[model samples]
Target: MPGPVFLEGEKVTLRPPEEEDVDLIQCWMNDPSVWRRALDVNPTSRQQCAEFIEDVLQGDDGVHCLACDDSAPLGLVSLNDSQYGPDETSRARDTELAYWFDPDHHGQGYGSDAARRMIQYAFEDRNFRRITARPGSFNDASVGLLESLGFTHEGTLREAAWFRGEYHDMLYYGLLREEWNSQ
Candidate 1:
Protein backbone atom coordinates (compact mmCIF):
# COMPACT_ATOMS: atom_id res chain seq x y z
CA MET A 1 0.00 0.00 0.00
CA PRO A 2 1.10 3.63 -0.54
CA GLY A 3 1.97 5.75 2.45
CA PRO A 4 -0.32 8.37 3.91
CA VAL A 5 -1.07 11.27 1.64
CA PHE A 6 1.68 13.88 1.50
CA LEU A 7 0.16 16.19 -1.06
CA GLU A 8 -3.21 16.30 -2.71
CA GLY A 9 -4.46 17.57 -6.04
CA GLU A 10 -7.78 17.69 -7.81
CA LYS A 11 -7.26 14.49 -9.78
CA VAL A 12 -4.41 12.88 -7.87
CA THR A 13 -2.76 12.56 -4.47
CA LEU A 14 0.98 12.48 -3.80
CA ARG A 15 2.39 10.18 -1.17
CA PRO A 16 5.66 8.64 -0.12
CA PRO A 17 6.59 5.29 -1.62
CA GLU A 18 6.15 2.42 0.75
CA GLU A 19 7.82 -0.99 0.86
CA GLU A 20 4.89 -2.59 -0.91
CA ASP A 21 5.37 -0.30 -3.89
CA VAL A 22 8.74 -1.79 -4.84
CA ASP A 23 7.41 -4.22 -7.41
CA LEU A 24 5.34 -1.63 -9.21
CA ILE A 25 8.25 0.77 -9.30
CA GLN A 26 10.52 -1.95 -10.66
CA CYS A 27 8.07 -2.74 -13.43
CA TRP A 28 7.89 0.91 -14.43
CA MET A 29 11.68 1.22 -14.33
CA ASN A 30 12.13 -1.69 -16.72
CA ASP A 31 9.35 -0.65 -19.06
CA PRO A 32 10.86 0.76 -22.26
CA SER A 33 8.00 3.16 -22.70
CA VAL A 34 8.73 4.71 -19.32
CA TRP A 35 12.54 4.65 -19.15
CA ARG A 36 13.20 5.76 -22.71
CA ARG A 37 12.51 9.39 -21.87
CA ALA A 38 14.17 9.27 -18.46
CA LEU A 39 17.88 9.76 -17.86
CA ASP A 40 18.53 6.12 -17.03
CA VAL A 41 17.57 3.65 -19.72
CA ASN A 42 19.31 0.67 -18.22
CA PRO A 43 17.30 -2.27 -16.96
CA THR A 44 16.33 -2.05 -13.31
CA SER A 45 16.30 -5.02 -10.98
CA ARG A 46 13.88 -5.53 -8.12
CA GLN A 47 16.78 -5.11 -5.72
CA GLN A 48 17.70 -1.83 -7.33
CA CYS A 49 14.15 -0.65 -7.07
CA ALA A 50 14.07 -1.51 -3.40
CA GLU A 51 17.32 0.31 -2.82
CA PHE A 52 16.07 3.32 -4.72
CA ILE A 53 13.09 3.63 -2.44
CA GLU A 54 14.97 3.00 0.79
CA ASP A 55 17.90 5.20 -0.12
CA VAL A 56 17.26 7.87 -2.72
CA LEU A 57 13.51 8.33 -2.53
CA GLN A 58 13.47 8.38 1.24
CA GLY A 59 16.71 10.31 1.56
CA ASP A 60 17.04 13.86 2.78
CA ASP A 61 18.41 15.20 -0.50
CA GLY A 62 14.98 15.58 -2.01
CA VAL A 63 11.24 15.32 -1.69
CA HIS A 64 9.93 12.26 -3.56
CA CYS A 65 6.29 11.33 -3.85
CA LEU A 66 4.11 8.78 -5.53
CA ALA A 67 1.20 10.26 -7.46
CA CYS A 68 -1.99 8.35 -6.88
CA ASP A 69 -5.72 8.55 -7.13
CA ASP A 70 -8.24 6.86 -4.88
CA SER A 71 -7.31 3.50 -6.34
CA ALA A 72 -3.58 3.22 -7.12
CA PRO A 73 -0.39 5.13 -7.77
CA LEU A 74 -0.20 6.60 -11.25
CA GLY A 75 3.36 7.97 -11.20
CA LEU A 76 6.21 9.53 -9.30
CA VAL A 77 7.24 13.18 -8.82
CA SER A 78 10.25 14.68 -7.15
CA LEU A 79 12.12 17.88 -6.35
CA ASN A 80 15.80 17.17 -5.93
CA ASP A 81 18.60 19.49 -4.89
CA SER A 82 20.13 20.89 -8.02
CA GLN A 83 23.59 19.71 -8.97
CA TYR A 84 25.66 22.66 -10.10
CA GLY A 85 27.96 22.42 -13.10
CA PRO A 86 31.61 23.37 -12.92
CA ASP A 87 30.97 26.96 -13.95
CA GLU A 88 27.98 27.40 -11.69
CA THR A 89 27.89 28.04 -7.97
CA SER A 90 25.76 25.71 -5.92
CA ARG A 91 22.38 27.24 -5.13
CA ALA A 92 20.93 25.46 -2.16
CA ARG A 93 17.60 27.15 -2.61
CA ASP A 94 17.13 25.72 -6.08
CA THR A 95 15.66 22.32 -6.94
CA GLU A 96 15.29 20.15 -10.02
CA LEU A 97 11.78 18.82 -10.65
CA ALA A 98 11.03 15.55 -12.42
CA TYR A 99 8.11 13.18 -12.88
CA TRP A 100 6.90 10.23 -14.98
CA PHE A 101 3.50 8.57 -15.23
CA ASP A 102 2.32 5.14 -16.27
CA PRO A 103 1.70 5.01 -20.00
CA ASP A 104 -1.76 3.66 -19.27
CA HIS A 105 -2.48 6.81 -17.25
CA HIS A 106 -1.17 9.25 -19.82
CA GLY A 107 -3.44 12.03 -21.20
CA GLN A 108 -5.67 11.97 -18.12
CA GLY A 109 -4.31 15.23 -16.60
CA TYR A 110 -3.11 13.38 -13.51
CA GLY A 111 0.54 14.18 -14.21
CA SER A 112 -0.18 17.86 -14.60
CA ASP A 113 -2.29 18.05 -11.48
CA ALA A 114 0.34 16.24 -9.40
CA ALA A 115 3.19 18.38 -10.76
CA ARG A 116 1.38 21.61 -10.11
CA ARG A 117 0.79 20.57 -6.51
CA MET A 118 4.45 19.65 -6.10
CA ILE A 119 5.53 23.05 -7.45
CA GLN A 120 3.17 24.75 -5.07
CA TYR A 121 4.73 22.92 -2.13
CA ALA A 122 8.22 23.76 -3.32
CA PHE A 123 7.61 27.47 -3.44
CA GLU A 124 4.94 28.05 -0.81
CA ASP A 125 6.05 25.62 1.86
CA ARG A 126 9.67 24.72 1.20
CA ASN A 127 10.47 28.27 0.16
CA PHE A 128 12.51 27.16 -2.82
CA ARG A 129 13.68 30.05 -4.97
CA ARG A 130 13.59 28.28 -8.32
CA ILE A 131 12.73 24.92 -9.85
CA THR A 132 14.25 23.43 -12.98
CA ALA A 133 13.30 20.52 -15.19
CA ARG A 134 15.18 18.68 -17.97
CA PRO A 135 13.24 16.59 -20.44
CA GLY A 136 14.59 14.85 -23.47
CA SER A 137 13.69 16.48 -26.77
CA PHE A 138 11.97 13.33 -27.93
CA ASN A 139 9.51 13.35 -25.02
CA ASP A 140 6.90 15.71 -26.36
CA ALA A 141 4.49 14.90 -23.53
CA SER A 142 7.00 15.85 -20.90
CA VAL A 143 7.90 19.08 -22.68
CA GLY A 144 4.27 20.03 -22.99
CA LEU A 145 3.58 19.21 -19.34
CA LEU A 146 6.41 21.43 -18.14
CA GLU A 147 5.37 24.29 -20.38
CA SER A 148 1.76 23.98 -19.23
CA LEU A 149 2.97 24.38 -15.67
CA GLY A 150 4.45 27.78 -16.64
CA PHE A 151 8.07 26.65 -16.80
CA THR A 152 10.10 28.65 -19.31
CA HIS A 153 12.11 26.89 -21.98
CA GLU A 154 15.42 28.19 -20.71
CA GLY A 155 17.84 26.26 -22.94
CA THR A 156 18.78 22.93 -24.50
CA LEU A 157 21.85 20.71 -24.64
CA ARG A 158 22.10 19.33 -28.15
CA GLU A 159 22.42 15.57 -28.34
CA ALA A 160 23.26 15.33 -24.67
CA ALA A 161 21.21 12.21 -24.04
CA TRP A 162 21.71 8.76 -25.50
CA PHE A 163 18.88 6.24 -25.61
CA ARG A 164 17.34 3.65 -27.91
CA GLY A 165 20.64 3.30 -29.81
CA GLU A 166 20.71 7.02 -30.68
CA TYR A 167 21.32 10.47 -29.24
CA HIS A 168 18.67 13.03 -28.35
CA ASP A 169 18.75 16.61 -27.15
CA MET A 170 17.84 17.53 -23.57
CA LEU A 171 15.68 20.60 -23.04
CA TYR A 172 15.94 22.68 -19.90
CA TYR A 173 13.10 24.57 -18.23
CA GLY A 174 12.91 26.85 -15.23
CA LEU A 175 10.29 28.51 -13.03
CA LEU A 176 10.98 31.04 -10.36
CA ARG A 177 8.98 31.58 -7.19
CA GLU A 178 7.85 35.05 -8.23
CA GLU A 179 6.88 33.79 -11.67
CA TRP A 180 4.78 31.02 -10.20
CA ASN A 181 3.12 33.40 -7.80
CA SER A 182 2.28 35.72 -10.67
CA GLN A 183 0.57 32.96 -12.61
Candidate 2:
Protein backbone atom coordinates (compact mmCIF):
# COMPACT_ATOMS: atom_id res chain seq x y z
CA MET A 1 0.00 0.00 0.00
CA PRO A 2 2.88 2.29 0.61
CA GLY A 3 4.16 4.08 -2.47
CA PRO A 4 6.73 2.09 -4.37
CA VAL A 5 10.27 2.50 -3.09
CA PHE A 6 13.73 1.86 -4.50
CA LEU A 7 14.92 -1.75 -4.54
CA GLU A 8 18.66 -2.37 -4.62
CA GLY A 9 20.54 -5.31 -6.06
CA GLU A 10 24.13 -6.27 -6.71
CA LYS A 11 23.96 -5.09 -10.31
CA VAL A 12 21.36 -2.33 -10.20
CA THR A 13 18.70 -0.62 -8.14
CA LEU A 14 14.95 -0.36 -8.64
CA ARG A 15 13.43 2.95 -7.60
CA PRO A 16 10.12 4.73 -7.93
CA PRO A 17 9.89 5.92 -11.50
CA GLU A 18 10.57 9.65 -11.89
CA GLU A 19 9.60 12.43 -14.33
CA GLU A 20 13.03 12.39 -15.94
CA ASP A 21 12.41 8.80 -16.87
CA VAL A 22 9.55 9.84 -19.14
CA ASP A 23 11.91 11.10 -21.82
CA LEU A 24 13.98 7.95 -21.60
CA ILE A 25 10.94 5.70 -21.82
CA GLN A 26 9.68 7.90 -24.60
CA CYS A 27 12.90 7.34 -26.46
CA TRP A 28 12.65 3.59 -26.00
CA MET A 29 8.96 3.54 -26.92
CA ASN A 30 9.76 5.39 -30.09
CA ASP A 31 12.63 3.17 -31.11
CA PRO A 32 11.62 0.68 -33.76
CA SER A 33 13.81 -2.03 -32.28
CA VAL A 34 12.34 -1.53 -28.82
CA TRP A 35 8.65 -1.04 -29.59
CA ARG A 36 8.62 -3.52 -32.43
CA ARG A 37 8.76 -6.28 -29.88
CA ALA A 38 6.47 -4.58 -27.39
CA LEU A 39 2.79 -5.37 -27.30
CA ASP A 40 2.18 -1.66 -27.78
CA VAL A 41 4.59 0.04 -30.20
CA ASN A 42 2.84 3.31 -30.82
CA PRO A 43 4.67 6.53 -30.13
CA THR A 44 4.08 7.67 -26.54
CA SER A 45 4.23 11.33 -25.64
CA ARG A 46 5.47 12.94 -22.42
CA GLN A 47 1.92 13.26 -21.10
CA GLN A 48 1.34 9.57 -21.63
CA CYS A 49 4.52 8.72 -19.76
CA ALA A 50 3.47 10.99 -16.88
CA GLU A 51 0.06 9.41 -16.80
CA PHE A 52 1.69 5.99 -16.83
CA ILE A 53 4.03 6.80 -13.94
CA GLU A 54 1.10 8.29 -12.05
CA ASP A 55 -0.99 5.24 -12.69
CA VAL A 56 1.77 2.99 -11.46
CA LEU A 57 2.44 5.13 -8.42
CA GLN A 58 -1.22 5.64 -7.46
CA GLY A 59 -2.86 2.47 -8.69
CA ASP A 60 -3.54 -0.15 -6.04
CA ASP A 61 -3.17 -2.92 -8.52
CA GLY A 62 0.56 -2.56 -9.25
CA VAL A 63 4.06 -1.33 -8.50
CA HIS A 64 6.41 0.12 -11.11
CA CYS A 65 10.11 0.70 -10.55
CA LEU A 66 12.89 2.24 -12.53
CA ALA A 67 16.16 0.34 -12.97
CA CYS A 68 19.21 2.51 -12.53
CA ASP A 69 22.82 2.57 -11.39
CA ASP A 70 25.21 5.41 -10.49
CA SER A 71 25.13 6.44 -14.14
CA ALA A 72 21.76 6.76 -15.96
CA PRO A 73 18.36 5.19 -16.59
CA LEU A 74 18.68 1.54 -17.56
CA GLY A 75 15.13 0.16 -17.62
CA LEU A 76 11.79 -0.34 -15.91
CA VAL A 77 10.14 -3.11 -13.90
CA SER A 78 6.56 -3.60 -12.73
CA LEU A 79 4.48 -6.01 -10.70
CA ASN A 80 0.69 -5.91 -10.79
CA ASP A 81 -1.63 -7.62 -8.36
CA SER A 82 -4.55 -8.32 -10.63
CA GLN A 83 -6.05 -10.92 -12.91
CA TYR A 84 -5.36 -11.21 -16.57
CA GLY A 85 -8.97 -12.06 -17.28
CA PRO A 86 -11.44 -9.22 -17.35
CA ASP A 87 -14.30 -11.06 -15.66
CA GLU A 88 -14.42 -11.91 -11.97
CA THR A 89 -15.38 -15.53 -12.49
CA SER A 90 -12.11 -16.20 -14.30
CA ARG A 91 -9.88 -14.01 -12.18
CA ALA A 92 -7.17 -15.15 -9.81
CA ARG A 93 -5.31 -13.30 -7.08
CA ASP A 94 -2.21 -13.12 -9.21
CA THR A 95 0.61 -10.72 -9.86
CA GLU A 96 1.82 -9.85 -13.34
CA LEU A 97 5.53 -9.18 -13.82
CA ALA A 98 6.74 -6.91 -16.57
CA TYR A 99 10.16 -5.43 -17.32
CA TRP A 100 12.25 -3.75 -19.99
CA PHE A 101 15.85 -2.57 -20.27
CA ASP A 102 17.27 0.02 -22.57
CA PRO A 103 18.33 -1.77 -25.71
CA ASP A 104 21.91 -0.72 -25.04
CA HIS A 105 21.76 -2.61 -21.76
CA HIS A 106 19.95 -5.68 -23.05
CA GLY A 107 22.66 -8.34 -22.97
CA GLN A 108 23.93 -7.45 -19.48
CA GLY A 109 21.24 -9.27 -17.47
CA TYR A 110 19.63 -6.07 -16.12
CA GLY A 111 16.18 -7.20 -17.20
CA SER A 112 16.59 -10.54 -15.51
CA ASP A 113 17.94 -8.95 -12.35
CA ALA A 114 15.08 -6.49 -12.14
CA ALA A 115 12.56 -9.24 -12.78
CA ARG A 116 14.02 -11.46 -10.06
CA ARG A 117 13.73 -8.62 -7.54
CA MET A 118 10.13 -7.99 -8.45
CA ILE A 119 9.39 -11.67 -8.13
CA GLN A 120 11.00 -11.66 -4.72
CA TYR A 121 8.92 -8.66 -3.73
CA ALA A 122 5.77 -10.41 -4.83
CA PHE A 123 6.45 -13.67 -3.08
CA GLU A 124 8.16 -12.32 0.02
CA ASP A 125 7.03 -8.75 0.61
CA ARG A 126 3.64 -8.84 -1.04
CA ASN A 127 2.78 -12.46 -0.12
CA PHE A 128 1.49 -13.19 -3.54
CA ARG A 129 0.55 -16.78 -4.29
CA ARG A 130 1.59 -16.67 -7.89
CA ILE A 131 3.08 -14.45 -10.57
CA THR A 132 2.60 -14.49 -14.32
CA ALA A 133 4.37 -13.03 -17.31
CA ARG A 134 3.52 -12.89 -20.98
CA PRO A 135 6.14 -12.07 -23.52
CA GLY A 136 5.77 -12.04 -27.24
CA SER A 137 6.98 -15.29 -28.74
CA PHE A 138 9.53 -13.44 -30.79
CA ASN A 139 10.99 -11.80 -27.73
CA ASP A 140 13.61 -14.37 -26.85
CA ALA A 141 15.39 -12.26 -24.25
CA SER A 142 12.29 -11.90 -22.14
CA VAL A 143 11.45 -15.54 -22.50
CA GLY A 144 14.92 -16.46 -21.31
CA LEU A 145 14.77 -14.08 -18.36
CA LEU A 146 11.45 -15.48 -17.17
CA GLU A 147 12.68 -19.02 -17.56
CA SER A 148 15.81 -18.34 -15.60
CA LEU A 149 13.72 -16.90 -12.77
CA GLY A 150 11.76 -20.17 -12.43
CA PHE A 151 8.75 -19.26 -14.55
CA THR A 152 7.41 -22.24 -16.40
CA HIS A 153 6.02 -21.84 -19.85
CA GLU A 154 2.27 -22.25 -19.41
CA GLY A 155 1.32 -22.14 -23.07
CA THR A 156 1.22 -19.93 -26.06
CA LEU A 157 -2.01 -18.31 -27.13
CA ARG A 158 -2.00 -18.54 -30.86
CA GLU A 159 -2.16 -15.15 -32.54
CA ALA A 160 -3.32 -13.59 -29.34
CA ALA A 161 -1.95 -10.15 -29.96
CA TRP A 162 -1.69 -7.69 -32.80
CA PHE A 163 1.39 -5.52 -32.68
CA ARG A 164 3.71 -3.65 -34.99
CA GLY A 165 1.28 -4.18 -37.88
CA GLU A 166 1.17 -7.92 -37.42
CA TYR A 167 -0.47 -10.67 -35.45
CA HIS A 168 1.85 -12.30 -32.90
CA ASP A 169 1.59 -15.18 -30.49
CA MET A 170 1.66 -14.52 -26.77
CA LEU A 171 3.75 -16.89 -24.67
CA TYR A 172 2.47 -17.27 -21.14
CA TYR A 173 4.78 -18.03 -18.23
CA GLY A 174 4.07 -18.47 -14.54
CA LEU A 175 5.75 -19.08 -11.18
CA LEU A 176 4.03 -20.19 -8.01
CA ARG A 177 5.29 -19.38 -4.54
CA GLU A 178 6.26 -22.98 -3.89
CA GLU A 179 7.98 -23.17 -7.21
CA TRP A 180 9.84 -19.95 -6.59
CA ASN A 181 10.89 -21.16 -3.17
CA SER A 182 12.14 -24.44 -4.53
CA GLN A 183 14.28 -22.59 -6.99
The Cα local distance difference test for each model comes to: 0.89, 0.78
Candidate 1: Cα lDDT at 141:
92
lDDT of each residue in 92-143, candidate 2, tens digit only: 6587898777889998978887788878887888777789999998888899
Model 2 CA deviation exceeding 4 Å by range: 1-5, 84-91, 163-165
Per-candidate clash tally: 0, 0
- Determine which window of 10 residues in candidate 2 has minimal summed lDDT: 84-93
All-Cα superposition RMSD per candidate: 2.8, 3.7
How good is model 2 by TM-score?
A: 0.87
Residue 69, candidate 2: Cα error in Å is 1.9
Poorest lDDT segment (10 consecutive residues) of candidate 1: 84-93
lDDT of 2: 0.78
**Model 1 segments beyond 4 Å from truth?**
84-92
TM-score between model 1 and native: 0.93
